[model samples]
Target: MKLLVLFSLFFVLCSVESLKVLVLFHMPVKSLSILGTGVVRHLLNAGHEVTYVTVYPLKNPPTKNFRQIDISKNVELVANDETLTMGYVLEHQIEKNGAYQIQVFSQENARQTFQNENLKKLIQDPNEHFDVVFSDLLESEVYSGLAVLYDCPMIWLYSMGAHWQVLRLIDHGTNPAFTPDYLSPNDLPLSLFERVEELWARIRWQFLKTFITQPEERKIYEETFGPLLAQRGRTLPDYEEVMYNASLIFANEHHAIRDRPATPQNFKYVGGFHIEDPVQPLPKHFQDLIENSKHGVIYFSMGSFLKSNSLPKKLVQELLNMFGQLKQTVIWKFETTLPDVPKNVHIVHWAPQPSILAHPNVKIFITHGGLLSSMEAIHFGVPIIGVPVFFDQFTNINKAVINGYALRVNLNYDLPKGLSAAIDVMLNDDRYSKKVKEMSAIYHDSLTKPGDEIVHWVEHVVRTRGARHLRSPAFNVPLYQRLYLDVLAIILAAVYLVKYIIASFDTKKAKKQSQKKKN
Candidate 1:
């Protein structure tokens, strides 16, 4: 009886020591989102103990062993935050510029969703030693302390919408958005002006990084986390260490979307992670309508958050006019009722997006260039015409154009005729269809399902103490240190001393020679 009790005690202790991970994604969850769904699935399947936290509630509850931590529960939302207005406006403009320069000194296009209060709640717990962390890079500073508190490796995931900072932060390259010279998709050799653009962007990003990552910010954060460390019997890690110690930098996208090289060793591309549930059945009425329609279908949607009807009155009118001109049936995912509806146009507040995309007769998708929508179009072998309003929509369209799978039209009043022309080109031409079909095959191959890859990696991190081998050593090396300016400084000082001494000796010799001649 004593032996059996001792063995049972031993097993319980073993379980506690096994791999533990904390996956933090402080973003709003949208319907059929792969980040929210796929991450939970992967972490659970990997057998690593996982905990998820967010700024807001998830649409679908967490599955498997993952527990969703409603961060609002622990931290109070600012009762009256004056900063809210500036913050929101700044975020919008930042998205527009495809770059962010905060206060003209600190600048990068990473998400800042982590409120100060969120950091406090994470550290208040004395005993939290996660083996590794998988964190969304946006507002990653929130987990800066958590990474240290656990004394573990971290994997930084990129925004589902790719940006230039992904290369800059994880791989130590310049932001490609600002420095398009180095990245030419058209296969054209860059001009001298383009070369200057690349060089200036590199210089600008370096300056921005130096300005933003300050000693003061680190000091304040350490001060906050120090108390938590004291309780746990651990010392605090430096800010540089906290930032660089991540194991792998993954993204919420697949390489098919953007397959750029990482200039540094630490970044790995395991994207296409926006996994969604299987296609759901269409509602009875919608299904019946689709079945009865003789002509092929055309699906129109503006995505969530932004209402297509919210546009200027003329813009809405133009869209109706264009839809009325088309012979194909239109299923418009408009959130509100329009003043006049065409016979062929159907408006619904919401639609099962994946299902509508799956319909065989559905030819082209009109979207806001959302990542999910773009991915869906590619995944289902459908072509697209994007109307970019904001955010990654521009990049999405650019990539789609580069890939020959889609076209873009800005929200102009003239869009009725322009949209009609673009739509006619797509429907008449077979190239877009062939291109998207080719992309779809590559998007989902037999071996690497996005969900499985994410699971394998999440488990790899937990199993191998964050698989620290994947972390970038460049993060540990300071920017100045990376430039190797110490060596340069030494060389310059030596050269200057030599030049001064040589000149002095040469002058003295010349004077001596002159004196000798005069004597």
Candidate 2:
């Protein structure tokens, strides 16, 4: 019995190996950082040492194994830059040129990151080492250079659903015929014209990437990483090749929330991983309002990026007037104080969204359709009315609408009536609640919890020395071979040759016939 117990202990000790991990999530968005921190927290809990490069550090006290490198100044810079706001996005019609805007902004962000003194020192240190590097798969691929510098496996974490552009990194199959672009507001089963539009968008993006984005990124890559490679007696790899060399991609998406496209073996879905289990209790005021509401509680937030204060005054008045008439209590996350408040409306500068969503009396969520918000709503089984502002918010809302759990309203001055009607329908209808609850069940029904799955995969990569076996074979194949363009060219040449020979023979026969006649 003693020997068996010792053997069991030995096996357990052998199974769990602590790894040093480097996590880079410098998007400066709280939602994006939340996803990264989720992975960081789980890794720490599992006895791994973590060095987190973040704009938002963990609020909880740091443990011995955790090290946070503060980059909050970057966040402040972005926040203070009015040009990066939603107002500018609207005023300049930025979404029309979102690809170019994103590329330019990402390059600038990466440039600043590389210039940070702490980050620079970390890179310059010869003794610094990490078993694996996890980075946000935002528009910036230059950060992947860190993994290359460390000589470790690279993993990408997408804060939202995986789109075609990022999927191309791992050579995952993408069919625009059915799958909509991340920025596109359209849903599946597209019409003929939509398919044509989608195809054109893909092609145009490819051209832009080749001609514009790639060159810009390469310049930054060479400028930043060239010296580091020289120090290590190594040469810089191709920028595009380094970006494509990721061993795993963990996307914050699941089949229950959206259509499942064909993905590579290395692509894993871990949506709703950030939602706290056994959600914490709401503040006393919030709890009282929710419990005492006769009809139900409605939660409204535009997420962290789009501030309610930024809304046009006339539109805000309209929303306030609309909310004043609702029978249910409304908890609005408004950044500024408004005078002449409605009796049934409560304004909060900040909201504990997950806790509020978990409340039994919370009926409907009025949101901007950000992926994290959508996932939280689904996790707690609350239906939402999405007023999407830009980018993937449109796509996220469209998916919820298709899933039958949410309604979408455009953000405009005259949206109060439409929004009121949507709220009324959601409040009265039971179908929306039922569908979201069903989705919540599906979201919860996974082999292991998302956090566990993430840690397992992270350790798995480190344990297996980069898990090269899991990579898609398509990664190695050239585009011409993959698309069979070379084969098509050969077939076309053979056909042309046959046609020429047949035409020549016919001409000779005709000439011989003419000669006979002449004789």
Candidate 3:
């Protein structure tokens, strides 16, 4: 009895020593905010204490065990953030002028977020200590200084597939022949022209980063975070070193959507962690509408970041008119009500999108092809009519179309006509629905829930003190060495030396032959 009592006490003590984690995610978009919150929720549920630094605060703050350093005011710094219209997106393709825009936006946000007086105060407080730091892997790598300051292992939570830039932090350069850039709209098994373009884009991005982007980012880091780290008696690590120090990268991607190159051991695919089990039931009125729809329902949402109402008023009217004529009950997620509503069309300012997708009556989803929305649609086995807009949406929708579960309609002035045709093809064709269900089964066949898997990895990193063995040594190797250029140079030099020796022997033999002839 005494032995059993001692064992029980030991177990209780072990359980109480949960990790103290620090999370820094300030992106204010609702979907990303939800994803970040989901990570926090899992850590809290696993009995870990978390200090979350974010721009979007929890509506119902945790009563205990969670502390929030809210810099919610930073959201205002991003202009027209709430109104990412289709027109705006199509006009600014990421490959063209969009990459620059993304860089500017990321730096601005990072500047505002990391430079906040309150955040600096938190950093200055020597009393605070943490076991690990988890950060959203954004375009800005400046925030990585947090891991350096805390002297803890860092885990990057990427809300998209492994981009070439993120891969650089973990391993070596990704092959452009097979791995498409995130901003690229091309699907794999790409044509020769597409491959050339992808290769050029990759090269151009690398050049831009090395020459222009990194220098600008370094300045921001020095101006803002450098002084803060110095004050804490922590020497700031070189910007590149801090990036390579990430212990693990949790990418929000899976093979169900698109196949990717072989990843390093430290990368985890936790794509659908945002999905809720036993999805919350829809509101009574919304449930009634879905249930009563005789001709099936078409759910339309441009995701949380892009507002459907932000479309040109004329375009909105045209869409309403087009939906009015359709036999299907159209459920559009508009941020505000239209002055006149069609009898067949339903407009809700905010949507319970996953719940709507899960409905048996929801036959097709018209979406902007955000990764989270794409994952949910696949999870619920719903076919999609993807109207791809800015950023990774084009790439996502292209993959879906290639995967046989979706049809793509570009956002243009003729959107209504294009969307109508795409919708007809998706609904009337049985192949789309059948294919998505098959993919859904594969997605659901994972060994554990994505959230649980993420939790397990987070705990693993904390317990193992950064899990350095899991990280790729390629991160430490120089680019020239990784490509074997030095070896090639050595081989060429040896060949030249052998050629020189042979020529010298031939010259000596010729001179002896001349002397013999003269004698």
Report RMSD (Å) for each prediction in the order shown: 6.0, 2.2, 2.3
Model 1 Cα RMSD, 1 decimal: 6.0
| 382-468: candidate 1 lDDT, tens digit per residue | 899987665556667767887889988765556677789889998899899899989888877747776777666666766777675
Candidate 1: which stretches are off by over 4 Å? 1-20, 28-34, 45-49, 59-64, 72-95, 98-123, 127-129, 160-164, 175-220, 257-259, 263-266, 291-293, 472-505
Cα deviation at 474, candidate 1, in Å, is: 4.9
Q: C-alpha displacement of 516 in model 2, angstroms?
A: 6.0
TM-score of candidate 2 relative to the true fold:
0.94
Query: 1-519 in candidate 3: lDDT tens per residue?
Result: 999999999999887778889988877666788888889988898888999998888889887799999888777865455425655664453323356666667777887887787787787787888899998877778877778777888999998987787888889868998888888887889899999989998887777777877788888777766786777776777887776778999999876765778889998899888888878999999999999999999999998878676578888888889899899999998888797878999998888888889899999999989999999988999999998877888888888988999998878778999988888787788999999999999899988999999989988998899898898888788988988999999999999999999999999999999999999
RMSD of 3: 2.3
For model 1, what is the alpha-carbon lDDT of residue 161? Answer: 37
lDDT of each: 0.64, 0.86, 0.84
Q: Model 1 residue 358 lDDT?
A: 78
Q: Output the worst ten-in-a-row residue range by lDDT, candidate 3.
A: 89-98
Inter-residue clash pairs, candidate 3: none
Report the alpha-carbon TM-score of model 1 versus the true structure. 0.79
